[model samples]
Target: MKSKTKRLFLLLLSVIFVFNFNSIKGTAGKSVTKTVRVGYYQNEVFQEGASDKAVKSGYAYEYYRKLSEYTGWNYEYIYGDFVTVYNMLLNGDVDLVAGLAYTESRSHLISYPDKPQGTEQYSIVKHQGDDTITTNPTTLKGKSIGVLDSAIKVALENFLKEKNIAANVVTFSDYDALLEAFDKREVDTLAGESDGIYDRSHAETLYPFGETDYFICTSKDRPDLLKELNEAQSQLFLEYPDYISVLRNKYYPESLASRAFTSSEKEWLTSHESVAVGYLNNYLPYSDTTKDGKVTGLIKELVPYLFKQLGYETVAIEYVGFDTYDELVKAMDDEEIELAFPVGGGLFFSEEDGMFISKPVISTLTDLIYSTNYYDNSKQIFAVNESNKLQYYYIANHFPDATIEYYPSIDACLKAVLKGEATYTTLNGLRTASMLKKPDYEKLSFRQLGYADDMCFGVKIGNEGLLKLIDRGLSRAGTEYVNNLGSVYSDDMYKYTFKDVLRENFIGAFIVFLIILAILILLLLYSVRINRKRIREKEDAKREIEAVNQEKFVFLNKMNNYMREPINNIVSLIRISENMNDLTNIKNNLAKMGSFSKELTTILNNILNISSFESGQVKIDDSLSLYNFFGKRVLIVEDTLPNQTITSDIMKKAGMEVQIANDGLDAYEKVKAAPSGYFDAVLINVDDRNIQGYLFIKKIRDMENDIRSEVPVIAITADESESGKEKIIKSGMNGFITKPYDVKAILDKLSGIIL
Candidate 1:
């Protein structure tokens, strides 16, 4: 009886355990069972020009929402630095990263989806606080600049590679906030695009002088997933109706149904005579695709039609996606993206390459996709490209309550949404519609916001041949593209309906579009404008180097002329007259001589810069920022007092207040006791018995348990060498302040932390 009773209990327990396990799965329904790990640059902003103070948004937000919708997967968003994101991906701590620009350099490090809904443009935003002239990179020589990401850092460094300029770059993960700080004059210049576009896209204050493009990128670890995305995207673009609508919504929403054209519109189509065009990817929306899944979009529809009208046969088109722009650029440095359309000129060159501008294409606007259950939450979450700054600011303005997460690329961002990773995501409109038509989109819906810029095709840096044609073609056929879009959609949705408008005067619009396409032949009429040879231009391609060498040559000539004077003076004083020299007087002469030589060297450098600037061929260092520091108080601690009082008075005159220090211990004690260590900084002289300046900084670092201890330090000394500087820096000083320094250097160092 006891054995039978025990067997019954055991069976009951087994049944209970299974029931609980199955119960959990039943609740999930179609949702993914596993937890998805997502990583973002927590500092990245969702809206353009907005900061962390704002909400989550941009292309990243829409893409992820779509992902969650499709997969029913739940995700944990991990926010941190680049290393943190990348390391997590490697460790399986993160299953995905989205909204990153796809490039060859990044592909080597991670996997990527084959589809790219669209490309991105970067801008250099300047603040109204500082002197706007200083906003020009060319004017900034020795200054501080703020930047985000290693890629941008490298681009800045490469830009100023040969220039003799000094830039102290401050990095941040969220570029939008950084720009806001810049507008507030916090960082000298924000080096990313968010602020840049806000300034440029508007008319009131911000000015964008330069721009670059970013892409949707990801790791290449999962081929199967990438293949799915690749196929799905291709199909998304091929849908004719969506492609036409995207153009309408992006560039001509007011004329969404209007087929009307001005006289200039008639001349736009005849422009693309004999062209070369390239496609960034083979994904949907940007290219044409079929039911089986292929690449097709507004670009694809327009490329062939435009090419045929350009009076060209068999236009050579290349399929070089996000990853290949660089390699192809190396092949076409003065060469083009080998693609033709009315797009921005700078697209052909990566942001690092810095090129020109093109006409215009339909704006590629991204939308925020959300799960059905998401809006019910009091606070929405936004996803965006971690590297995109402008998207952050715009998002913040609209969704005030959202928290943001950064995804590496657009595909992964939407994937996060389809998998239910977040409450919101920003996505391309055409893509959202096409994806919705799919079986997966049943769980997703697109929240129609405003529109993005007119998306365009790309060409080489200096190629006006194709650009002129595109502008003319676009000018003429643009109305038709708009009209056609109207015809493609239902009357209710299409509003103006291209068929009705075009039918009224369709032949006239087409004829005008064709006329402009024919007139593009004049861009090549080069007889009036001869290629002028510039002696300066030929040598100025590498400006700094030639200038420095020229200075060296001038120095050698001076040395040759003055070589005998010092020796003769010495000999004459020693051999003949008592009046010729007093030992003390001789020492004074030598000191004065050394001082003059140093001044001369400094003056020469200043002269070289003036020369570079005058040439009009000199490129500015992208990394530099012009700053001003005056009337600031900095702590000075040394084992000795100022005997000369010369350095102190000079520092005071240069707009700085100096705190005196009689000993190392006194300086340390004084700095520590100050309210919150209220001093701007500590400048320690390294001439003590045991407590030298270098060691003093190290000790302070060790004492720092809170934010106060993280204060900046500078070792004021005469030792400036590779190893010596390294040792000094490692000792925990923010940097070095050379001894016998001029008032300028002192003021410059203090400017960074204060201003």
Candidate 2:
């Protein structure tokens, strides 16, 4: 009986243990969604619209949403000013806060994850046009800098102390106030975090410094939450390694320089006394070798500029020119050329001829150049440069049935099209513009192919250190600098003088002059004989002839001025296109040429109305209203809803995309968000009740982004006084229109300015 009882007791204990184990497992399997309080403030991309419950969207906000997928955490956001929200997290009123850069002082009050979200760089900013100060710290020694009363102020103070530079640091309550003080000229400069959310459109970063990692912080009391958050973040990132980068790209279109050359890269640079770069000699406007063996192209200018950014001068570089890309590649393999320049980013380099590509220097769209007699061919034949695998593959994939003929270079490919040996050839659209300047290529018409290529520098595979240094230099130089370089080179190429026009047109103008002179001499001889026939009648007739002669001279002078003005403009454009070698500018000049041709036609039409000279003078009617604004986009800034509708309707009727902004502030934001050339024109309501339209336009004009900053603007107002008109012009507006939108007037003004 005793043995049976002991066995029963053991079985009971085992049953209880198994039941307990199953219950614990069930509890662990079920996910318990935890509610965490998150605190934030109104900072641009990091945390925007945080104060509003309806619209909470930003990088940090997106991060939390993504994190919830892993942690099953529900968040309740608490918003306040930056300091208030930070205090809330410290006091445990909120469990979490994001966008805090890790600092030793703050670490005591908060616990952070093992990995940071991203980085922020504090920088000094100035008016975009200000060149008084540079990246050199010495230039800022005595300048008064405006800074926010936040981490940015801390960074500025630290930077000042580190550089041993004494400058007055004025603090403001917030970013808006800080920028306001900067605009008022209360400070010589401004310092703030350099990020996408910052309004860089009107401000330029003088120099970036104090780069540090920012993290999502948890209250010290919530150590458990911190651990859970850390594990979830780790697993999340492990699954999608590019999660952070994807968020950044989605929220921030502009990138900041965050790279410094390592010791090895610097060593590589020092060891190389001179670097030889090979380029195709026929790639005009990009890189080309002159008859005298002098390199004169954008790539030639760019290489020196990039090197200068890395503290080296142009003397350290040598350019080697090749007629064919194959030759350039051969030079690279033989170590005769250390680098190949202006290489297409999509280019393929085989393992045997290994090469590394640097960051893109510039990107341009492609163009299809074809003979005017393309229809004469029964089958489409594409002429491709033998070394351009990108073009060859692109044509093969897009036109499977088409035949591709290989050529030695872009020049040869184009010539094939001109000779009718091929139906078409593709080249960089910008480069193609320079080619068309040749009179023979004029027989070939071209259009954009909706394709683009990034031009980069190529280095041998073994010289990765050099490639990294080049990439660092490119990053430091920045996109804005590269774009400016492109503009400068393009302008240089297209340069022309009044002397060129005079030389080209001298023969034609002289021939017309001789014909007019002969006609005048014959008329004088005929009048003299008529004068001698009658005496008193001769005197009256002579006086009458003199009056007619005076009228004729007046008419001729007026006609000459009107006709010659447009002719001079047309000739100037042609010469400029030849010199500039820029395709975009060529298109713009071509439009201008069309306008000039229309003006000439108007003058001719007026001449046909000779009967209008019955009043002893000729009257010319130069009014034209054949405006075709189809497919154009315009921004209409109007406060009143009805006015917005009316103006929008008018623009829409003309087949334009009419974007409306309720106020000047809204208009400024819209303009800031848009890409360059996105809007063909902007129409501002100058008498806006909220912000003055004149001030808004001035802000746009001061924008650092050249695309929208240089966009044409017209003001809408009730005031039609001469002073009001003068004010609009002085405010940097292209033109103005009185209130109560006139469709014809709007179309005409836009056509003249944009079209």
Candidate 3:
């Protein structure tokens, strides 16, 4: 018994110590009372259908009553007008005050819950039959306006003064006193709380104005308690959603009540007030960009709605590159963007958002396209939008084993396939269909890759409130305004080029294929016909035709020979003229003789060649025979600065095209630049300076080379140098000139050199 007692005593001591330790840690049995002091006007609306009949059913009492039940704590109502509540909270006398507006000054006195439970609008109460002030609030300027002696009334007066509407503010004892004055027409526009106005609407005589929300005010000393109250208020909101629903309806009277947010969204709103979004620019046609570079399209219209409904005023849209669109979504695993519009991109690769797509998108239309050429290929690799995995699954179910590579934008996907880099790409059906109006329309044809789906801006899973807000705003903006922006950017984005639309379109392809087939058949037939015709022609009229051609060649050769000798001889004659006398003495006489000879020759050659060719006897054989050298001294002439360039190129191709002359004077310079006895050849155009080739050659021989100033120099010219040989040879040249020359005779005389 003694041992058992000792053991029991020790065990009891351990249990007691553990219990006391837990109590010291504020855990085991401690109940912390998070006091939320509810302070508002001791009015009927606040006390609601309830514990006190004096207070009517309104936000203050109804909200606090629900909050008390939610947090298992009672709110001690500090009933008063503005001063009693403000002073009580300011002096650390209470924890929270209701029916308050957020203010810059008030922000320092309290820590707000980051999001408004809702917004507050106002009503302007005035005396009945007061037509003057009802027209504009400006009539109140410098006029006495009765205000309840409250902080809100002070703020209202200050707001009116800042707007340049001055008012003589009179402090009334309570809302009842303010109402009584308004009935007497003693003040201008009377300011009333929206809730107060809403509450007073029940009374028969006094008129209530407009409607708005009233906020709960909290004290600086009890911030933790304020947070507890806020959390309790949140639970109250979940339990009695009608409280927020009524407020929502008052603000958006035309809007329908939306389903409340799940617990997750409610939790998110308590933490953050802004959202981050994303856009991918490359997906054209379906989704494209604007000039100032903001996103606009079916999806863009949805983002503003998402933000407003979630109570976020600011949005940061990340214009992420297409390659990184899905990567940004992976950040949602880390909550990088609370909500994003994976945007007007493909729907085959990134659809995790679809798993949670509680919101409805307006439309979805898609098409599949492939290379127009190489018809047998159906194994296609497609560029899918990797960000929307649900969308990816949605597409893959139809085309299993269809290799889908993730692409950031639809534009990138289309370009990849159009450029023959990828085998296939899918674009929106409406986007693809309307693109046919663009010039590039014929370049591709796409039936529905499948069907269209409604497109909405996506939110990372937890942002349900914002997603719903987007739906609301979109419904407000309507589809017509939404589709108009789509048309403009689409016209700008998927604008097709001439080649893009026309090249390899149906008609061109058929023509090209038929032409290839026809050519192949013609080649086979021509091969059989070629030999028989060749054999017969060789044995018969081939020789006769050859003879006729040979004769024509000889006849032209004779004509060239007849003219060559005299021009050469005349040039020789002129070379020795300097020996007899000065050129100044002989210039005019020589010029006359030379000019007369040239005129006679032009008339003759033109008559001969032009008549024969017109008579159809002359036919040119393009057959060229290669030879090693030509010995004739060829003189080449020009009236302007001539170049070694033509000479060098011809030398490489056929050994020195001809000698170059800069001007008639420079022709003489070229002769001067050559070595003594250097020129064995000469070919000259009549345009060679204004100086005559006759004069040039005469100068060449007179200048004296060791090869005998008399070496045969042949003149080639468009000009006809047609003097008789005796006089010409007697004067100085070896030749006249040939125009429209034969390649063979020119070579004959040139290579006729013996030594």
Better of 2 and 3 by TM-score: 2
The local distance difference test score of each candidate is: 0.50, 0.73, 0.53
lDDT of 3 by residue, 616-719 (tens): 34433233234554442344554422122222223333343356664445666766766655666655554333557667667767864344455455555554
Stretches of candidate 2 off by over 4 Å are 1-87, 92-96, 99-243, 248-258, 313-315, 345-347, 350-353, 376-378, 385-402, 407-412, 437-443, 487-520, 524-546, 553-755
| Candidate 3 off by > 4 Å | 1-273, 284-301, 305-322, 343-355, 370-394, 401-424, 433-441, 471-481, 495-755
In model 1, what is the error at residue 665, expressed in angstroms? Answer: 85
Q: Residue 369 CA error for candidate 1 (Å)?
A: 42
Higher-ranked by TM-score: 1 or 2: 2
Model 2, residue 265: C-alpha shift (Å): 1.5
List the candidate numbers ranked by TM-score, top first.
Answer: 2, 3, 1
Q: Could you say which candidate leads in TM-score? A: 2
Q: State which candidate has the highest lDDT.
A: 2
What lDDT tens digits, residue by residue, belong to model 2 across residues 179-290?
6788777888887777732544456566786788889899999988999889989998899999888888777655433333455676887788788888876565667777
Superposed Cα RMSD, model 3: 35.6
